[model samples]
Target chain A: MSTFMQFITTGLRLGSVYALIALGYTMVYGIIKLINFAHGDFIMVGGYTLFFTIPAFMKLGLPGWAAVFIAIIVCAVVGMLVELLAYRPVRKRGNNLTSLITAIAMSFILENLAQAIPAIGPDPRVPYMLFNNDIKIGSFSISVATLITIVVSAIIMIGLYQFTQKTKIGRAMRCVSEDKQAAVLMGINVNKVIIITFAIGAGLAAVAALMYIAQYPKVTTTMGATLGIYAFVSAVLGGIGSLPGAMLGGIIIGIVQSGTSTYISSSMADTFVYLILIVVLMVKPAGILGKNIGEKV
Target chain B: MLNIKDLCVSYGAISALKGISLTVNDGELVTLIGANGAGKTTTLHTISGLLKASSGTIMLDDIDLQKTPAHKIIEYGMAQVPEGRHVFAQMTVLENLYMGAYSISDKKKIEDNIEWVFHHFPRLKERSKQLAGTLSGGEQQMLATGRAIMTNPKIVLMDEPSMGLSPLLVSEIFSIIKELQKSGITILLVEQNAKMALSIADRAYVLENGKISMSGNASELLNDERVKKAYLGA
Candidate 1:
């Protein structure tokens, strides 16, 4: 039972990070119908930002939380900058194929550019040990990092729910997602709403990065590229456009990975995640909570 | 007051509106009546800044609407009840109403407009929590009108308010249109139901093939021999 508990706790920690990243993918897709392939790279950007800032801040006698704050701010600005400079032109042209190609290109550019930069070279840098303690309940032991990740993600999710449901700007996001023309007719600045969406998604990626590094501690230029794929899969699993769906999908995928690694082979864990994705695609193409909207006549 | 002069719109090789001009004066309910493809809806769209005019001037009071973007047109006191009743299908009726007041920042004013909308369409109030997609055809039309009204505009552009409704619902909708005019709102109505539209309009224009074929008092057009033969189904 204690072993089972350990697996559950570990799975949840991984799932929380996945959920945060998946949300960025789902939100951009929901509003613009663009998959935003570069969303994952935003995490790498956040990690690198933290790597440089945390050490520098520590030397300047600032606490580590200040580094996290700066990293998040930097990532949010990068996300919005990507939207403004890279994505907006293609979106305005009304070319989905071009927008998608641009996203993929942006992803490559972000990853390769980080490697090419002298300061943030290809080598992996271990993050500052922010939470190193462990919490023992009964015979099972879990790291404080895991506990913080779960709690922080939950708070973020709750905050997101309130913003989307109760706020005017959040409502505009929903309106734009449903019908762009209708939203414009209702006097909504669709472009502004989209920019805000990108900013929020990127900020979430940064937070996810912080929590993610808490568990793994290693940061690499290519880390976001691999983790992005898993998060994208999670978004698809949960219904790409649905907020709650992204969270649920992340948790399920986490559990599956943990189970496979524990019972089967750790080497085959990723294979199982993909296999489940294939089955889901064949059975329910819309994902778990996604509504299959009929094309308006 | 609103005015359009020589508005021309084209979608690629096909021209939807060719040199169409019309005007709606303050506190008057004006209707543009025509058959399908007669440029009635196109005229409203051009005025609302949804479709760009090839070469024309749209003046809404002191503002030049021709240069305005679609999202900003409503701020100049123009709201459209679109032809097909384009309510946000996924949103609840109450949420849809809130979206209608998207430009307004005052929370109290938004609430007041919502209450006013509910007063106008009590059925909307009954189904306030319901998803707009699930509403009946007439109910959706009512919701569309209510949503537009919630914007608190000076001039309301209604495109096909009576489209796809039962006879009973049609009369109910027409009555509401009359009630809306009495409430001090200027209106620019576009309709394929020329008979009903002409009867309520303070002034009317007959559009054919993207041009103003005739213009006069609504009651005069209702009795004219040409209108009686072509539109009144006499």
Candidate 2:
């Protein structure tokens, strides 16, 4: 039972991170109907920001966690820049293929740019530890980092829900997603809403990156690649455009991955995760939470 | 007042509006009537800055509308009820009205505008928490119009508010439009239902093939031989 509890904790921690990253994917998809293949790189960018800033801050006798704010700002700016410089021009073309291709190209550009940078290079560096202690509870132990990951993710998720439901800008985002031209007629600046969406999505990704490296403690250019694919699958499994679906999908994928690795074999973990995705697709193609909206003529 | 002078628009090589001119004086309800593909919608879209004019000018109270972006055009106190009653399906009716008041930042004003919409559209008030998609066709039309009114615009540009409705609902919406005009809102109405549009409008313009073929007082145009033959199906 304790062993199972341990695995559950691990699953929840990993699931929290995946849920955060999936939100970035889902939101960008919701508004623009683009997959934003570059979304995963925002995590890598956040990771590197932490890698560089954490030590620098500790050297100045400040808390390493304070670096998170800087990383969030950096990721947001990078996300907005990616949207403005790359996606906006293609979006103006109003061709889905062109936008998709652009998103993939942007992903490659970010990955390669990180690889080519002299400071970053191809080396995998260990991130500074934010929380190393663990809490002991009735024959089961969970790391402080794991608890923080789940709690923080839940808090952020709830905050995001409130923002989208209660705030004016949040309503505008939904409005733009529903009918962009009608949103424009309502005096909404569509471009500004999109830019803000990218910012928020990428900012959440930064938080996910912090939680991620807290557990794995690795920073590499390609680290986000696998992580991103998993989150993308999570978003798809949950329902590509639905926020709750992304969260549920991430948790399910995380549990499956942890369970497979714990009981079956580490090597079989990914296979099982992917197999579940295939099975879910077969059964519910629109995703678990996705509505099957008929295409309007 | 809205004044559009010699506006020209094109979709690449295909000119949609070929030098059309029109005006809506303050406190006047002007209707632009035409058949399908006669550029009535095009004229409204161009005026609202949705589509750029290749040449010519659109002036709303001395502001060069040609220079304003589509999103900013509403700040000049102009709102459009697009042809399809494009309510945000996932949003509640109340939320849709809040979206209409997007540009207005004052909290009290927004509340008051919402209350005003609720007053004018009591059905919308009752379904305030309901998702817009669930509303019937006539109810959706009311929500759309109520949404535009939330902007509190000096001019409301309505495109086919009666597009798809029962005859009873058609008369109901027309009566609401009449009430809005009596309450002192300037309107530029575009419609294929020429007979209904003519009956309510103070003045009218007959658009054919992207140009204003005739312009006159509404009652006179209603009696004109050409208007009756071509539009009224006399």
Candidate 3:
């Protein structure tokens, strides 16, 4: 029972990080109808940003929480720049193929940038529990860092929900996604909305990075590599473009990974995750919450 | 309030609006009526900047709009309530209304505009929280109109607002158009139902095969033999 509890605890933590990154992929895809391959590098950038800023933040007598907030904002601003210089022109031309290739190029550029920075130590292993102390209950132990991640994630998701449901900007996003020409006629600047979308998604990925490093305590040029794959998988498992669907898919995947790893060898754990994805695809190709996208040819 | 001189718009090699020229003074509800494939919708689309004019000029209060991008056109005091009532599907009715005022800089003015929209479309108020995609056709049309009005443009452009609506809803929509005109907002109206389009219009233009075939006072055009046969089905 205690062993089972460990899996549950660990699964939730990993799942939470995957879900946050997945939100980035799903959101960009939802609005632009193209996968932002550069999104993975946004995660890597977040880790490195945190790495360099932590010392300065500590020197300034800022708390761990403040440091995380600053880091996320900085990363978000960097994300906005990427949108402006890298993605916007391609998007404006309405060329999906070019946008895809541009995103991939941006991802590699970010990863290389991180490697070029000194004292980032080439492969900066993010120290575990750098901020949070742990909480133990009955023979099972859980980190306060993980708890913080869960709480912060909940707040972010809620904020996103309200933004999309109650605001003018949110409505504009929906209209543009439905029909770009119609939205332009309504005076909704499709380009500005797309830029904001990228900023928000990248910011959330930064927050996820902080929480993620808490458990793993490792950050390298490729820190986000495996998680990116997993996050993409989680997004596909959920309905692409369906916000709630991504959340559900993440949790399901976490539980599956944990449950399988606990019972079987850890080497086979990834296989279990893949198997579940296969089952989900076989059962419902659009995913658990995906709507069927139609093309009028 | 608006003038187009020799306006020509095309898609690829095919001309959609060929040297169409017309004028709509301020405080007038002008309608363009034509059959399917006739250039009615194209003229509106070009004016609203949804489609570019290949050659010609669009001037509203002296703002040259020939080279302006689509979203910026609204900033020049024009808003389009598009065809198919393209309300934001996932958004609530209230949220859709807010989108109309998106570019407005004044917070208080935006708030007042929302209240005014709610006042004008009381049905939308009742269903304010319902997702617009779930709205009935008429309600969607109402939301579309309210959304445009939120921008508080000097002029509103509507394309086939009555399309896909039942007869009763069509009447309701026309009444709303009348109400907007009474408030002194210049309107550019396009429709397939020429009789209904001409009835409320101050001036009417007939478009055929991508050009303006005739222009006259709405009541006068309604009685013309050609207009009567093609549009009124007389």
Tens digit of per-residue lDDT, candidate 3, span A1-297:
888777887788778888888888888888898787778778888887777677677778876556677767877888889889988887778598988899888888887877886766476665434756779887777778777777778778778877876677876777777777767876778988988888888998898888887777778888777888888889999987877877778777887888888888778889999998999999999889987743221
- Candidate 3 local lDDT, residue B196: 89
DockQ metric, candidate 2: 0.69
Interface RMSD for each predicted structure: 1.8, 2.1, 4.0
Quality of candidate 2's docking, in CAPRI categories? medium
lDDT of 1 at A291: 86
CAPRI grade of model 3: acceptable
Clashes per model (N, Cα, C within 3 A): 0, 0, 3
Comparing only chain B with the true structure, the TM-scores of all models are: 0.98, 0.98, 0.98
Question: How do the residues B1-234 of candidate 1 rate in per-residue lDDT, one tens digit apiece?
Answer: 998888899888889888988889999999999888898888888888878889989999889998788899998888889988989999999999999999888999999999999999999999999999888889999999999988788999999988888789988999999899899899999988988998899999999998899999999999999989998899
lDDT of 3: 0.83
Across A168-218, the per-residue lDDT of candidate 1 in tens digits comes to 999999999988888998999999999999999999999999998877889
Query: What docking class should model 1 receive?
Result: medium
Instruction: Note the Cα lDDT for every prediction shown.
Output: 0.90, 0.92, 0.83
| Candidate 3 lDDT, B1-234, residue by residue in tens | 899999988989998888999898999999988899988878888888777888999998798877788888888889988888777776678777767777786889988988898888988889998988788888888898998988788999899998988898899899999999999899999999888889999999999998899999999998999888877879
* Candidate 2 regions with alpha-carbon error over 4 angstroms: A294-297
Error of 1 at A90 (Å): 1.1
Clashing pairs in 3: A126-A217, A126-A218, A126-A219
